[model samples]
Target: MDFFNSALGKNITFVRPEYFIITGFVGIPNMKYYYIFLFFVYFVSVLGNGAVMALIFLDHNLRTPKYIAVFNLAFVDLLGNTVLVPKVLDIFLFNHPFISYNDCLTFLFFCYTCLCMQSLNLVALSYDRLIAIIFPLHYQVKVTHRSMLTLIASFWAFVVTVNLIIAGLLTRLSFCKSVVINSYFCDHGQIYRLACNDNTPNLVFGRFLIFLILWLPMVFIFLSYSYIVYTLSKIATFHERVKAFKTCTAHLSLVAIYFIPIVITFTMSANIHPNARIINLSLTSIFPPMLNPIIYVLQTQEIKVSLRKILKTRMQTKVMAKKVIIM
Candidate 1:
């Protein structure tokens, strides 16, 4: 309160609430099943993303610009799930929906930050692919380790700054109305609407956020792929073009998994039932992290080869240990 008063000026007094009740899944029937499903998703997400990160870290062969982006994606996925799932389960499954005002804002910050980063990460991968396919002759010079790290670092700085501004704006709002957030997490839209004071800043920023995080990234990816197709068309041989296009399959799958559900949910928000909308949005957040590593492992040849090599080495080491014990 003191900080708000001091920062917002003495003329404006903000009414802050102690806690907010999350009623995201309150009316849904048989939500226990959904909780079980969330638990399974979280478990797989942790394991899969962890393995991907570990593989990228341990295998020197995977220390390329593309795998740098892959490693970042895996890290974001692991972080995003860890921040979201268990809290959701506690809120809905355990029937504890109360979240402190500061805590709620922190939740919103992390969730939105990770979600935004996921989109930007895809954009990074798209850039990686676009460069690889369109400008293969200069790929090594253009997409070096320093350049990739710099790109990812710039993205982190931008996203974190935007989300901090978001949380800071939320702090100025007076929540004199209902303290019940309809979403599973501390959604920015829901929280802003609950404010009794003028939330015009939040409202305007919310729209800007949608564009920056979702629409802009989607447009970039679309144009990148379009250019990639154009470049591939100029290749002399059919097999060569096919071989070039195949590299993008894993990234394309990830883009679809991440963006498609979000597009559908936002497009149909008015027409869809509230419960259905919530379910869709929740799934959109949770599913991608779990599926991303799986998609890479299955689709990308390098990851598969590296995984096999690591496994074989471990197996040989185990056999050697057993022989020594027997001797």
Candidate 2:
């Protein structure tokens, strides 16, 4: 209380509650089944993303600028879902929807940070593809391991700082109106709207975040692909053009999976029921992390090759151990 008062202004009095009730899935029919589905999705997401991260760590061939972005994407997806799903289950599934004020702010910080990073990681991957496709000859020079690492590190710094500001701003608002948050998680928008005092700062920043996290990244990706398409048009052979486009299929699929649902949900929000909107938003959050690794494994030849190589090596080691035991 003193901290928030000090941080905001000495004259201002903040009316914060001990806890806030989450009512995101309340009144929805058969919500237990939805929680069960989330459990399944979380399980698969852990396995798939873990496998991708493990493969990247174990294989030297994946130690390139491209896989650096891929590794970061997998990491963000794993973390984003990890921060979101378990708490969601605890709150709704286990019948514990009351989160303390400080805990809720912390939850908002980590979830929003990871969420922002997921989109920016996609931007990193898009940048990798843009350079690889557009400037094949200078790809290595332009997209170095050091450079990619720096770019990813910069993204982390930026996203973490932004979300910290968001969380900090939330501390200033006095939630005298209501303490029940209306989203699946401790969503920033939901929390701010509950404030009795002026939330213009929060509201303005929220809009800025929408542009920064969603629309800006989407625009960058779209432009990157457009450039890639333009560059591919210059290629003389149809086979080469097809091959080049094929390299992008996995990334394209990931972009679609990550953005399209979000776009639809937000655009159609007015027409959609609140319960339906909650379910759609939840699915949008959980689905990409589960699907990203699968799409990469199936579409990206390099990941497939790495998986087979690792499996073959493990099998050969087992066979050799059996031979030694027999002798």
For 135-180, candidate 1 gives per-residue lDDT tens digits of: 8899999999999999999999999999999999998888766899
For model 1, what is the alpha-carbon lDDT of residue 13?
72
Worst 10 residues of 1 by lDDT: 3-12
Structure candidate 2, residue pairs in collision? none
Against the true structure, candidate 1 reaches a TM-score of 0.96
lDDT of 1 at 309: 98
> Taking the tens digit of each residue's C-alpha lDDT, what string does model 2 give over 55-146?
99999999888999999999999999999999999999998999999999999999999889989999998998898998899999999999
Locate the minimum summed-lDDT window of 10 residues in model 2. Answer: 3-12
> Which candidate has the highest lDDT of all?
1
Off by over 4 Å in 2: 1-13
Off by over 4 Å in 1: 1-13
